[model samples]
Target: MGFTTRPELRGTFGAVSSTHWLASAVGMSILEKGHTAFDAAVAAGFVLQVVEPHLNGPGGEVPIIVTPAGADEPIVISGQGPSPAKATIAYFRKLGLDIIPGTGLLPACVPGAFGAWLTLLRDHGSAELEEVLAPAIHYAENGHPLVPRIANTIATMRELFTTHWPSSADVYLPNGEAPEAGKLFRNPQIAALYGRILEEAKTAPSREARINAALDFWYRGPVAERIEEFCATESVWDVSGRHHKGLLTADDMAAFKPEIEKPVSVAYGEYQVFKCGAWSQGPVLLQMLQLLADTEIARLDPLSPDFVHLAVESAKLAMADREAWYGDSPEVPLGTLLSSSYAAERRALIGETASMEVRPGSPDGRRPILPPLMEVGTIPQPGLGGGEPTVARDRQLPNDSQGEPSLNKEGAQRGDTCQVSAVDRWGNMVSATPSGGWLQSSPVIPGLGFSLTTRGQMFWLEEGLNSSLKPRVRPRTTLTPSTVHRGGVPYLAFGTPGGDQQDQWQLLMLLRHIHGGMNLQEAIDAPAFHTDHLPSSFWPREISFGSVTLEARFPGETVEELRRRGHVVTVGDPWSEGRLSAVAREMDRGSQIIKAGANPRGMQGYAVAR
Candidate 1:
C-alpha cells in the first residue's frame, strides 16, 4: 500500500463516512448540528438514494447495526421487510420458472428503506424528520451532478427503457439521452414526493406521530396504492425471458414495519463483533469469526499468501454454512454453530491447498440442508450485470459497479447497495447497508417516483431451506451492516456495498486492521480477494469452486505463488474490488475522539471529520 490518498483521520468531535461524498457531507452537517448519529445515518441514507440510484433506491432494504451511547448491547434494526403475502415459490413455478428472474416487477417486495430509516430516527434521533431528510429533498428536487458511472449505467439500459418501461424512460431519459457525466441532473418528481411526505408529517402532533404519519403515507397510502395498482395491471420481462405480474399488495405494505432485535455477536479477542441476525446475511461474518476465534490471526502478515489463504478458506466454510444453515428462520442452531467446539471441528476442514468443493457442516447433530440445485445458464458477475441497462460485460475485477444483470443472481448477481457509518459526539453509532430497486430492475411506479425492490428474487423456489420463500417472511437477504466494540466499548462502525462479497471484503480489511496492525486506510488500501465457491443466493445461482480473483496490485511473486497452490486465479486491476469505509470512536483522556477512513478505489466514497 504505497501512499494512500488519505490518512486515517483522527479528530476530537465526530466523523461520518459513506459510499458517496455528498452523503457524507450531509451526515456530517447533521452531526455538527448536534443531532444524533441515527439522524446523520438516516440523512445520509436518503441522500444515497438520490445520488446512487443505479445502486440503491428508496425501494431498497437496509439491515442496520446500532450501538447507542450508554447502551449495554447493540441492536439490529431490521429494515428489510418480509416477502409479500403472495410471493410464494409456487407462484413463480406457476409462471413457468424454476428460479425467480433477476429483473422486472414480479420479484419485488414491499419497499423497506423508508420504514427502517424512520424507525431509527423515531427512536434515536434528536432532530425533526424534515431536518434529517432535507438534504436529499434539496438535491433530488433542484439538481445534483450526475456521476459518470450512473450515466453509463443508464445508457446500458437506454434501449430497454425505451422499449418496455416508458415510465422509466420519462424519468431517466428526460431529454431523449442518458444524462451526461458531471452534469446537473434532477428528478423533480422524487423531490416533490419527498416534499409531500414532509408536509404531511409536519401536520402530526408529535415527532413520533409525524414519523408514523409519513410511514403510513409511503407504506399504506398513495405510494402503496400506486405500487399495487401498477403491479397488478402490468407485467415485465425477467431474466428467464418471460413476463410476470407483481405479487405484492398494499396490504403487504401496510402489514410490514421495521423490527428491533438483539444483534448476533461473538466475543473475538478484545472485541465483540456485532452484526444483524440471519434474517440478513450478517451472521455469516460472525460465524466466520467464530471459526477463526482460536487462530493466531494477529500474528500473520497481512499481505502474505498464508494469511490470504486462511481467510479465503474460512470464508468458504462459513459461507457454505450460510447456504446450508443460515436463513430467516428462528429455528437456526446459531448457539451451537458459534460455539468453540464447533470451530474446532470445522477448523479441521481447512487443508493446505484450495478446496473446490462446497462444504457445509453439522451443528448439534442437525444436517445442513442446501438448495435443491444452484441454477446455471448464466455466468454471474461481481456487480449487477444481468439487467438490460447494465448488461453483462467483463470490465475489471475491482470495478465499483454492480451491473444490472438481465440474467443473474437475485441477492448478489442482479443487485447492489449503498452503505453508511456515522458516529456523533453523544456516542451514538450506526452502520447501515441500503440496497435494491435498481432503475433497470423494474418499471418505475407511475406517480410514485420510485420502483419497488426486487428483493423477492433472493428467495428460493425450493422448500425445507432456511431461506425458502414463504408469505410474510423476509428473504435471507445479503444486505449486512456491522458494529465492533473494543475492550467492551463501542469502537467502530463500518461496512461496504458489494452483494455476497460484502463480508469477504470486510474480512480482508478487518483482519489487516485488527490482526496485522495496519491502520484503517492502510488496511483498506491493501489488495483484496474473495472466493465464489459457495452456491450464490441470487437468482440463477452459480458457483465457482476453487476460484479466486485477486487485485493485480498484489506482488507478482505472491500472485504466482497462489496460482501454484492450485487456485484458479483471475487477476484484476488494482484499486477495483471493494468500497469499504469506516468511522471509529474512542476515549482520549476523558473525552471521546473520532477517526475516519474511506475507500479510494471507487473515487466515490468519502470521509468527513471535524
Candidate 2:
C-alpha cells in the first residue's frame, strides 16, 4: 500500500526474479520458449555466471530448492562441492598455516556449478542442452556490459593479477588495464570452453545422454584434466603472503556428483517453510522462526525497535547454533535443533537488553562444542587478494582491526553471492543461491576463463568439530536459499546474496509479510538490518559481540532506542543492506497466478512476469 521501489508483478503465466536484470530477462525468455521453471532457472543461472563474474562463476557452487508442479514436497539440489582428499587439517598444519587462505589455489574445491546445472537440466527440465547454454555462451563470446561493482572489483585486484596471477591478468586485465564500468566486457575463453563441451555433448544420441556427456566432459574428461594439470604444476600467490600449489585433482572432480535430497521443513502457522539441509546455513532461518513462534511477533510493528530487537536476538541464538552444530557431517543433530521445545529453551535467553555473549544451546542434552575463536588482531590482512567481494563500508577501521579483507583503507567490501528464483504457470518453482569462485577469490585457470572456488576457507583448522578441515568433506557454506508452502502447497521461492546476512534479511522480509501484512515489494523495500554477533562463516572468522547494522532509512528515534537496548548500532547508507529476490505462485478463483518482487538496492535486481 505504501510507496514501493516497483510494483509486485502479477500475472497468469510465468515469473522470474534474479540478482541481475540480464539474467532475469534470460529466464523470461526461456519461459517464453515454453520451457519449465527448471529450464528457465538453469538458463538464467548460467547467464549469471557470465554477467556477475565478480559474484559467481562456473567454478563456484550453488544450492537450489525446487518443487515440481503437483509434487508433495520440495527437494534440495546440493551443488556444494566437497574438499579434495588431500585437504586435511594435518596437511594445513604441516604447511605452518592455522587457517586456509581466502584466495589462491590451495583452497580450491571441485567446481560443482557446471555439473549441478547439467543435473537440473537432465532430470527436471524440458529444454535441450544447447538451448539452456546458448544465452550464456552468446554473452561470453560477444560481450555484456560490466556493472560498476565488477569494474571496481577488477580495479581493486589489478595489482595482484598483473604481478602474480598472469593467467587472471590475461583474462581480466584486457589491454593491461581494468575494464571501465558500463563498458562491454567479454571472456571468449569461457565461450570457447562451453562450445567445445556442447560439441562433445552432440556426440551423444539422446537429450539425457547429451547432458550426461557434458557432465563427463566437465568432471572426468578434459576440463578436470586441465584443472588437475594446472594445480599440480602451478604455484600461485594467495592471502597467506606466499605461493602454494592446490590440492584438488582430476580424481576429486570425478568422485563428486551433486545430490538431490529432501528439504528440512518447519511449520509456522499456516505456512511450511523449507530449506536445504545443514550443509548450508538454511536451517538457521527455520530455527529463527521457531525461536520467535512463542512471542507476540504478529502484533508488533515491523519497523519498531521492539521488532528489530526481537528479530536480531533470535538470529543471534540461531546463528550460534549454526556455528556449533551445522555442517556436512552426520553428527549434526538438526532434528532436535529445530524442535519446538529446544526453541523454547533458547527463547528464554532474551531479556529487556541485548546479550553480548555467543551462546549455543544444548540439543537432546548434548553439550555443545564450538571451534576455537580467533582473537582480535590475530587474523592476517594481506591486502585486496583476500576477502569476499562486497561494498565498502563508510566507516574506517585500522588494518589490524579488520576481520574480512578490504580493498582500501576505508573499510571491508565483501560481496559473496548471487540468487535466482523462478515459477512457471503450472506451479513449478525454484530458488537458488549461487556463490564462490569470485574473480577476487582465486586466480583464473589458464584457458578456462574462470577461477576455482576458495570455499575451503570456511573450514576451521581445529580437529573433532563439525566444521573442521577434513579430506573430501564439505565446508559448511553460508550460501542458502528458501521456499515456502502454504497449506502444504508450494507458494513461494526466495533468497538473497549476503554471506551471513542472507537468512537475517530473509527473516525480516518473511516476518513482515506473514505478520505485518505487507506485500513482497513492501517487505523487500522496508529498512533492513542484521546482527554480526556470531562468528562469520567466511575467512578470518571474526565475531562482533552485540553489533547491529541497519539501513539509514530506519527512523532516528528507532536507532536511539536500539542503542538504549544495548545493541551496538551502526547505520549504513539507505538501500545498502539487502539484494533479495522472490517469485511465487497461487490460485485465484481456480485460476493459476504468478507473482514476483526484487530488491531495488544496487539497481541490478529485476523481476519479470507475463
The candidate that achieves the highest lDDT relative to the unseen native structure: 2
- Ten contiguous residues minimizing lDDT sum, candidate 1: 406-415
Give RMSD (Å) of candidate 2 vs. truth: 2.8
- Predicted structure 1: clash tally: 20
Task: For model 2, give the 10-residue run with minimal summed lDDT.
Answer: 393-402
> For each candidate, C-alpha RMSD in Å?
3.1, 2.8
Best by TM-score: 2
Q: Each model's number of backbone clashes?
A: 20, 5
**Model 1, span 1-610: residue lDDT tens:** 4577799888887899999999999999998888888999999999999998878898888888889998877888898978888888788788777767767887788888999999999988888899987899999988889977787767767777897788899999988988898998888888989999998889899999999899999888998888888888897765655667888889999998898999988888898889888777787888788777778666877667777778888999998888888778888888887787898899999888888778888988887888754423355432323443332312223344432343112212223678899998888889998888788687787776776788877788888888888899888888888899999999998998777788988888878888777888888788888777766666556666677778877787777777888787777777767778899999978988898999887688999997
Q: Write the per-residue lDDT of candidate 2 for residues 1-610, one digit (tens) a residue.
A: 9999999999999999999999999999999999989999999999999999878999999999989999989898989999999998888999889878778888888888887888888899999999989999999999999998788778877777877888899999999989999989999999999999999999799999999999999999999999999999999877667789999999999999998899998999999999999988899999999999999888998778998999999999998899889988999999999999999999999998999888999898888888766544555565444442322221223211122333442334444588999999888999999987888878899889999998888898887678888889888888889999999899999999887888999999999889888888999999888888887776667777788888888899999999999999988777877789999888889999899999888889999998
Q: How many collisions between residues are there in candidate 2?
A: 5
lDDT of 1 at 419: 85
